[model samples]
Target: MNNSYFWLRCRCNEDIVLLKDPKSDNRSRGKAFIYPKERSYKTFEIKYSNKLSTKAKFILSSFNNKYIYYAIDDLLYLLKSNPTEKENLLTVLYSSILALHNNLEINFFDIWIDNIYINEIGKNNRFFKVEEQSQTLTHITLTLFYRTRSPFKKPEAQW
Candidate 1:
């Protein structure tokens, strides 16, 4: 269970942390294991290896030594002041989700919450984009959306 090694990239500044061994590159040098949770859910475990991916390499370049909590706080403050700037707000939330998911590869959950609802944005497209809503600083409604789909979908009974 404690066998996997991981290369964690901090969400705030993309800081890279090489779990277990410190002498090797964060990417291309670890094996991530998927661990089961209390229910039927799965997570990842970190293991050591020597294979790196191009995406991992790009992530490693701007790796910092900090996490995303700090950035989230700052973004929250900005969102509070400028309620109309939609693009910047979404970027902040997206980066935070990425940071949370990047760390601890031993856990097998998705980076963001799994509450997905299907909406027909366009009849011709016939596909759904993932969307999540959060409260803005001034109690306004902020809806965030990404044009993507998750491969995992729990059974209806589980919901």
Candidate 2:
């Protein structure tokens, strides 16, 4: 499998750019690898029927709000302090991990932790589970499917 590179900024105002498995990078890749590609060891398959409502479970009025940022910071700290081997979670986790370890800050304002819908997606692309307590610190695991392919870029879509 060929790896690619991209950039992201963190809450601390640091820039992070690095090479990583192409499957997860969201910008400029121009291609999307369908699930079950390479991280099979980390993905989990959940039954299709057990679905959660799409209505917004929680919403923060603004990122600039003190309580919102604090809650976000706390969530990030919690996710990083305790690491998991699950690929998708680990993908986001390790991506954040590398950025911080390298002193690069991700633009946390652009990506809302509460907006991450890992549990909402079902069947195929749905890959992990997170068990939380009081919506704070928690446990997470990933289930990867075992099919590998290099998908070509579809026009107007960015992966």
Candidate 3:
């Protein structure tokens, strides 16, 4: 079987990529696998809505035309050299995850440095205006490789 992935720009202007798992059928056989646990497995459904939540707004505005793809391994190197930048990237990632959980009741199972793409803005002199000082800013976009949702059930009573 051929395994490959590609990126495409969505209508929102953000890059959208689909990642496929080679061993998806045998997911339950391994313990070190990246897929979510069996108990959390739920069917994926989409609810068409024109409204955006406050959390979604904040997350979108955070990456609004501020950065472009820098490098694939930028996060790995940044962890050793720049602590502040690393923290900022992590905060955005976690905040996004939280927002998704709260807004859609969805959960991202795999989140790691490799899944994050780093983008650098204000790094080129040609893109800078005379009045605006150039400052390199790093932004992150996370790719969800695996996700799952649990069935809606009321809390069980403990006696």
Cα lDDT of model 2 by residue, 1-159, tens digit: 334655566888688755565676678655532233232222222222222222212321222223223444544554453333122333443454344334433232322222222344323323444432113222222221223334467789565
How good is model 3 by TM-score? 0.36
TM-score, candidate number 1: 0.20
Model 1 lDDT per residue over 33-85, tens place: 22223322222222212232333223322222222333344445544544444
Model 3 poorest 10 in a row by lDDT: 40-49
- Cα-lDDT of candidate 3: 0.44
TM per candidate comes to 0.20, 0.17, 0.36
- Pairwise lDDT winner, candidates 1 and 3: 3
Where model 3 places Cα greater than 4 Å from the true spot, the runs are: 1-30, 34-82, 107-114, 123-134, 152-159
Per-residue lDDT of model 3, residues 1-159, tens digit only: 345444556899896776665555555555544433433221222221223333333443444222212221343353545555455544555565566567667644432222434444554576667666545554445543334455889989998
Ranking by lDDT: 3, 1, 2
Candidate 2: list runs displaced more than 4 Å.
1-69, 72-98, 103-119, 124-159
